[model samples]
Target chain A: MSAGTGDSVSLAAAGPILFDLVAVIVREQGRLSEIDGQTGDGDHGVNMGKGFRMAGERLRAQGEFTLPQGLATLGDTLLSDIGGSMGPLYGTFFTDMAEALDDTDRIDAPHFAAMLKAGLAAVQGLGDAKPGDKTLVDVLVPARDAFDAAQREGKSFADSLAVMKAAAEAGLEATRDLVAKVGRASRLGERSRGTLDAGAASCTMILSALADGLVQRLHA
Target chain B: MNRIINDPEQVADDAIRGVLLAYPDILAATDHPRVLRAAKRRGEGKVGIVTGGGSGHEPAFLGFVGAGLCDAVACGEIFASPTAKSFHEAFKAADFGAGVACLYGNYAGDNMNVKMAVKLAAKDGLEVRTVVANDDVASAPRAERDKRRGVAGEIMMWKAAGACSDEGGDLGQVIAVAQKAIDNTGSVGIGLSACTIPAAGKPNFTIAPGMMEVGIGHHGEPGIAVMPVETARGMAGLMMDRILEDQTFASGDDVAVLVSGLGATPVMELYILYSHVDAILRERGITPRHRFVGNYFTSLEMMGASVSVTRLDGELDRLLAHPAHSLGLTVLGR
Candidate 1:
């Protein structure tokens, strides 16, 4: 597994890459639910875990699949099996990302950035939340911006991913200070402040996992 | 935690199964397990009526499926909106030839899922329109009424849309009536205690024993204010004040009233509350043309009650009187 092949991970390994993402969600289910309980119905973890686990099971049975195929599978699973705002939000995110990466054989910095942008656009369009609404958009916008900025500055793919992960972490923490202006928590007003939005927390974890998985698969 | 169920995670699924077993004659299974259609199919060319939301609101979203109500329902996890796939499937199940009219509450999840479902239905050449109920006046200010969340007043919206569809209203007409129904309606709730999500294993929020949450949402979303628990009469007066303040009911106007127990509250208590509500309406010179008091919509095991009033005109009054049959509601013909 030592680096030697190329500067990008082959899209052929999408199955394993996505499985890792699913693992992260499964592991953090309890934490996500706890955060959501603070200002939401508290089913985010259970619903997200259920949908991811279903996709994980299918991926395991499939054994081998392209990155686009894997992303579509996960996206469709969430959109169809999970009911809630997350279902459509994340569903559109992954599904649109898959569509952006469709027909691509390998993921490089430019290709990855496009996928991120696509997912962000689709989610933003669907949820109608802005950058500071204390939703997942809080994390997504910053993370994507950081990645694009790093790439534009001519940073290496791995370095760009590192910055993206860092920005995502910062973005997630920022939600703790912002008041929710949309979604279920908006009704909570000032009470919604001081708590990390569940969507932002989960989004950070997802972005971190994706960055780590891609960095590990990068070759010299 | 002491719930009658198998796995806490499977509560929603298991409940759906039980519903099918108990009301096989009233509801029929759809292609997707999460979707259910009415058993007694109406004639072709009638506008289809569909609604969906999270589970745990027993007989709601699902129980409302029958001859003159929702033709199909998409069920989601407890207090979560139904999946886009389920919504699309429910739309399919309900549609016979004419377009489908989706009547649902104004929640982020439901809104997004219904939007996606509408897109999917369009691909299948089926037309779908939606009317989001935002009758919980306390959820938002009058200037931002569009932002308020839907509450028990959803039942009123459903009844109106279903009756319009049954009476052979076009999709536009049905949507217009449903929109009008919710726009003319106002609702408010008071939470005396918190309810636990089965999977969460504990109450997400709490209401002090001596205090109550005014304008509490169905899923325990924080209300506008928390104050000392008032007597049944006082509580009724407070709730009436909120609703009346949001929507005007002129003297001698006819209105439909609904009093729903939030799961843990007893029906006897609801009746107690209703007595005061009735008296208040009479004092205002408003006639309660139709009244429903029971657990029409509930937030699983939450001890509370919500009051809803929908002003009626000749059309809405006739629609409310239209004979309808469903697990959660039934109206006899004139």
Candidate 2:
């Protein structure tokens, strides 16, 4: 993805990079399930890994995908195959993110920020969970905000991505001390404390993988 | 354990194949593998009735698809919600020009999936309405009833909604009846053992050999209390007390009682438990207008049973008595 040796990347060439994200989820499936087992049914890994792998295989077979096309394909696969709440939740998230970039040819800090915000908004619209509810929101809100803050500070796109990833990690860690107020884990109430939220963990992994992919492809 | 499955991950998919094979006359496959429609479609202008949820409940989601029951169903993985695409497909399959009424349990996944599916269906110009069933009184306190997980009581909601739709009720009428059915119902379960999700390869939760969990959910979600195993009468009395406390079923009230085994339990045991439930209702001057005793809705192999009672009025009574046919339940003209 060429950015004229400047601060943006070409959305046309950013598709294949998502394969890296698929690999991350597939690789960490076990760990994700283990974390969920502490407070949930422990199938988070199996379900998320299954959806991501399916999307990855389909994209590989299709031979080419623009960033928006790839993300849309991934979102559609998850929405179709994964039946859990995750199917709709993450499905809408990526699908909405893809929609935000539909008319854009290049991805810059502002464009990236908009995509992140669209994804987060889609999730919030579907579920009633807020930031401290020990869900992906915990990671997603902070990640998007950090990226926006860094961009407003006039930081480079790469530095903004790093800041976003760090904020996502911090948000994920913050869930361990919070009582779950939504989802299946919320049934545990106080017992849910001390366990890293499975959704938050998955979100962090996704955001980290995304940031790394964008950083690698940023020509400047 | 010794599960007869080809691939653990494909269990849900394979089970659908088997169900289709066994009930070819009653059900037909949709474009989506996870959605099924009734073999005999109804005429246009009548509101369509649809219901769906995670699979392992067997007769629940799919079995309910028949002539006078759900027009279509979206099947999910065991103890999981069906995908939004699947739900949208189900809505399309069920729609016959008068809009579709989506009736389902109040689970987090199902709620999210259904919401997305409704949005998708709306985009396609197909109107889809929904009624979420939350009749398991033991899952949450009375003040938090909305947060309760739907259990066997969902059957009553479906039966009423199905009857209403079959009688040519409009979309709003179908939705209102479904909501009223669930509102007049309450359910609670006693789990004696745990069941495994084929993909998971092990039991997700466990119960002691000599102990039982009261108010346990279909997926082994923890309930209100855990105590030593009790007699059939004892279990019936305990479950009934919780339900009556949640809903004011006073003397002279008429109700429909359904006792469903949680998969592994025998039919004889369900009747044994139902006998006590019937006796308790009669003793309280509450008449049991209808009784459904069997494995209507179930967990994979969890050893337990749930009791559901719907306080019936003139409308609910007439609706419940309406003839219907499905693999999970069947009613003949009375």
Candidate 3:
């Protein structure tokens, strides 16, 4: 794909990024639990919504924030506020991403790729999950690779983000046929099949909302 | 849907407030609201004992925080693990110059949180070791015992570990005995009905009427068998069969028995089940040295019971007999 308009988004305009994520979590709260209830405790949406809402409120109180600042706040809130395996896993994911973008005011393709790679490394450091483990890593790994592939092909930043979102969605859907190898659902063994992993579903929603938010602010 | 709670989302916070008020002499709040330390301090040189889990299992994660038991506890949302920050704060609360032994169940959330907490504690120059309990026999095959989920038998691990620490054992000794306690212990549960997480507003799983789930997990996870509900006598036989198959108790062995109701189960029914369990033990020539029957650990309000048996050697017997003062289980004897 040829590079569409060579454009970038200002990190400052992404301060409200988590607000969009909170809305998505709030909207999909019941759906996420419904999916989790199939093989797990059915609180993925509740916990995610609680954390995202808390992050959004904190961002609003700050009045103005850069994208990295907002993500760091979200990460801190999840790490300290939410419990369960998801807390540390996602907490490190966002915190590491924020750290990668700490010095960047303008988020270009390479910067976004670096942020995601850092986030993935942080998550892997915290949990022993890999792709096909039916965890958030399922969505994250494929999404990150898709974003990097698009960037390498000289696609516009917005186009790369769109590719990441589509890849995440596909990865989320693929979890339904895979048995859980990690987390609470792993106890079910074969029974964990035929159900979408709660973490993967929420990860998809977060990535899609984030990509959409960044895309809206991309300026040529 | 009928629970005595203020806000579904704030159940953990509200219940903690009540716990602090109800057990003023037993627990003290830490800087982190989610962590509680023993009101009676363990002076220097004693290895601290810590344990924690989700909040719905009351008289559990927090109720066990007291002298001679857990020195500190990290409370979590219902059926969830406590935050890493909370676990780290609990480690700090229990740290008394000596190292701390964090004895908790083997669940994914608890494992991850404790791993992070240990990392955080290391940064602060604190030493924290862990012994994860995996006494539920039906969760996995014998070859995959490490994958099993911890059930009510975790209380036995804490009982032995806490007493060992109280006896001035070092951190390594405390963890060793706790690991032995869990290794010798075997437990299984039967769920008559599933419980609901207040926030979820519905049961995570279900048990059909007149049916029971054998080997059910503490969080309502499906079990190995779902058969028609049997008589208390029959249920005891089934539970003991699984427990015994996992851990061999010789004819002359002594064991400690714990029959805990899964929240909503009546105390009367637990005693009824315990009677049958005692009879089965007698038939096998296994002597029950100490028997504890109550809602020691539980789901939110699940209608079921779990039976845990810990084969006691000399060291475990002495440790089990140690004086412990906690809201959940108390032994008062020198």
lDDT of candidate 1 over B49-157, digit per residue (tens) = 9999999888687989997888999999999999999999999998889999999999999999999999999999999999999999888899997899998999988
Model 1 DockQ reads 0.88
Query: Which candidate wins on TM-score?
Result: 1
Clashing pairs in 1: none
* Candidate order (DockQ): 1, 3, 2
Candidate 2 per-residue C-alpha lDDT over B102-146 given as tens digits, one digit per residue, 9 for 90 to 100 = 999999999999998999999999999999999999888989989
DockQ per candidate, 2 decimals: 0.88, 0.74, 0.83
> TM-score for all predictions?
0.98, 0.97, 0.97
lDDT for each candidate structure = 0.91, 0.91, 0.90
Docking class of 1: high
Q: Which stretches of candidate 1 lie over 4 Å from their true place?
A: A1-6
lDDT tens digits, residue span B1-334, model 3: 9889888999999988988898899999999999999999988989888898988888888878877789999999999999999999999999988899999999988999999999999999999999999999999998998899888888889889888988989999999999999999999999999899999999978899999999999998889999999999999999999999889888999999999999998999999999999999999999999899999999889999999999999999999999999888899966
Q: Per-residue alpha-carbon lDDT of model 1 for A1-220, expressed as tens digits?
A: 4332445777885447898889999999999999998888787898889999999999888888988888889998999899788999999899999998876788888889999999999999998899899999999999999999998899988999999999999999999999999998898889899999999998999898888888777863
Model 1 chain B weakest 10-residue run by lDDT: B58-67
| lDDT tens readout by residue for model 2, A134-180 | 99999999999899999889999999999999999999999999999
